[model samples]
Target: MIIGIPQSRAFKWSYRAYVTLFFIYLALPLATVCAFAFNDSVFPSLPWEGFTWDWFFGTEAPYIGVFHESPILRSLVTSGVVAFWVSVLAVFVGTCNAFLFVRHEFRGKAILYVLMLLPLIIPGIILGISILVFSSSVANFLEDATGLWFDGLRPGLILVVLGQFSFITTFATLVISARLQKFDPSLEEAALNLGATHWGAVREVTLPFLYPAMAAAGVVAVLMSFENFNTTLMLVGSDAPLTITMYDRLKLGSTPVLNAVSLLLIVVSALLGLVSLLLQKRKD
Candidate 1:
């Protein structure tokens, strides 16, 4: 039997064309970047000189690969560290938020939920600027009053993690909350009836159910934190993340090393996404 609505030949061809073009639009740039990553030429663009592993492994002056480039490697490490903290914090806070919103009712619950989403609604640059200004002000006031500087409040990796956490936690909360909504309350009740304490019930029944979502949320948070640019740029101090470092390098000039970095990121992101899908499928 026929499934979807019957369409005219013209409509079918048009739909196919649209899908083809859409995929081309999406994949062409990435394909170009990946291609240039192996190009022998120093420039990332055009006239494929020849294939070479220089961009990935060369340690020569002009052919310094991403692995060999100390600055890029340092930035990669910095990004990893920031992403780790952001993921941890986002997942923990998000799990708590999921529990709070799903299992409890309180005054102004709706308002509070809306407020929690404000960070996502605001522009990233605006959010970064606001956090920077507010934190600087607070730091200044504290320093004046206490006559001691608080480096944590300055624009640094800590602030970058916090800024990213502000929005990433919302995503984590939404993911975990969606999973929580599907959970059976009777399971927890049954656990309690079986002599489990409240916390024990949650730990045994609810948390196991939420494990997949929490893991997926953590993956998303890591990817988001690693790739975040606008917010990280504002909050970053001496230790720059990969995105900021790439931006700085691009401002100077484009190179195949950057393309190699992009390719690596794309592969890593795809793997994380696959892991998320596997987790979600396991939950199902």
Candidate 2:
């Protein structure tokens, strides 16, 4: 028997197959990683020994869990602190820049706008190196001139925050500016006509409208700062962030603890995403 050609049906089936394969390809590795987190193996790779929580909470010999791991825990703390500060600072500065760029047209408005975006165009490594060099030069100058040493400006968490901020804030500015573009200018004008001062209008009317966008930008800043490796690696001093610690550990050897950390991160990220969705739903 000869089969009849069904071109349209075949095309639809082919399209669905492609999409299914695409998603499976993306999800399979992550699924494997999560599964490996529970595997009771010295190594994170295949041939699972058994299911165990040794990697997550063990305080004993070879199976010492991530919680008992001091260096990794310390690096995790550093990542959190840096991410928190970076999120706060980036949102504040980026919101200010977004308002300035959207609301005003000064003499150098176009030039300043381009300058603000330069950070996004630049590579992270270059930004990190530039910041490190600039800070070192300033520290040296201050020491030579004032004869007072200041290690605060050196390569450390502060430098890491600054380095991440250099690009992250640009990201935030773009987000806030996009949201600001959709805003109706007349509302602010109406507030002004109703006897509200410029600052009052901005504080009460404008910022409330921008809260969702700012929150989203803040989330992006935290995630970026937490996972940042290239710039962070260059700027980090004696104390490293989670990404740096993970990299160092991989360089030495692989372990199930790494998988445990990855699993924890995935869980935290999922929780954050759920919270964001709930907030957005309420707003809607």
Which model scores highest in TM-score?
1
Model 1 TM: 0.96
Q: Which stretches of candidate 2 lie over 4 Å from their true place?
A: 1-10, 273-284
Q: Worst ten-residue run, lDDT, model 1?
A: 275-284
Q: Model 1 over residues 167-221: C-alpha lDDT tens digits? A: 9999999999999999999999999999999999999889999999999999999
What would the per-residue lDDT of candidate 2 be over residues 1-284, giving only the tens digit for each residue? 54685668889799999999999999998888889989988898878789999999998877889999998999999999999999999999999999899888889899998999899888889999989999999999999999998797899988999999889999899888877887888999999999999999989988988888888889888888888998998899998999999999999987789989999998888777666455333442
Candidate 1 error regions (>4 Å)? 1-6
User: What are the per-model C-alpha RMSD values against the true structure?
Assistant: 1.5, 3.9
Per-model clash counts, in order, read 0, 0
* Reference-based TM-score of each model: 0.96, 0.91
RMSD of 2: 3.9
| lDDT scores in order | 0.93, 0.89
